[model samples]
Target: MQAVAIMKQARISPQKARLVADQVRDLPVGRALEILRFSNKKAAQLIKNVLESAIANAEHNEGADIDE
Candidate 1:
């Protein structure tokens, strides 16, 4: 099962966030988080937060044992 998270009315511009997203695209959650954690961009933090929420939702709603 797949999980999703949405952040409405975020302060950052979509164009800026998309730049961060493009870099993290197709990466494993662990790897993505690593990149996000060390990234100096504000959008990286925003995307990281949403990704964490999605992972939590998958565990709670779908009972998927996402190990970390």
Candidate 2:
């Protein structure tokens, strides 16, 4: 099963989001959320929303086990 979620035309720069994304690279979902939650950057908040949406989509549409 597969699912896709996308956020478009966000009012943030790719460079700024990349900084936060790099920190979460290759990390688990829980750990990434923790990092994003504590981050005080605009880009972090945006990226966090996207990540959460992806998780939800995987769970609802794909019936995937998020804790695997």
Candidate number with greatest lDDT? 1
Judged by TM-score, which candidate is best?
1
Candidate 1: tens digits of C-alpha lDDT, residues 1-68: 56899999999999999999999988888899999999999999999999999999999998988884
Q: Estimate each model's TM-score.
A: 0.93, 0.88
TM-score of 2: 0.88
Write down the lDDT that model 2 would get: 0.88
- Per-residue CA lDDT of model 2 for 8-63, tens digit only, reads 99898889889999999778889999999999999899989988998999998888
Error of 2 at 5 (Å): 2.5
Candidate 2 RMSD to the real structure: 1.8
lDDT of 2 at 59: 94
**Per-candidate local distance difference test:** 0.93, 0.88
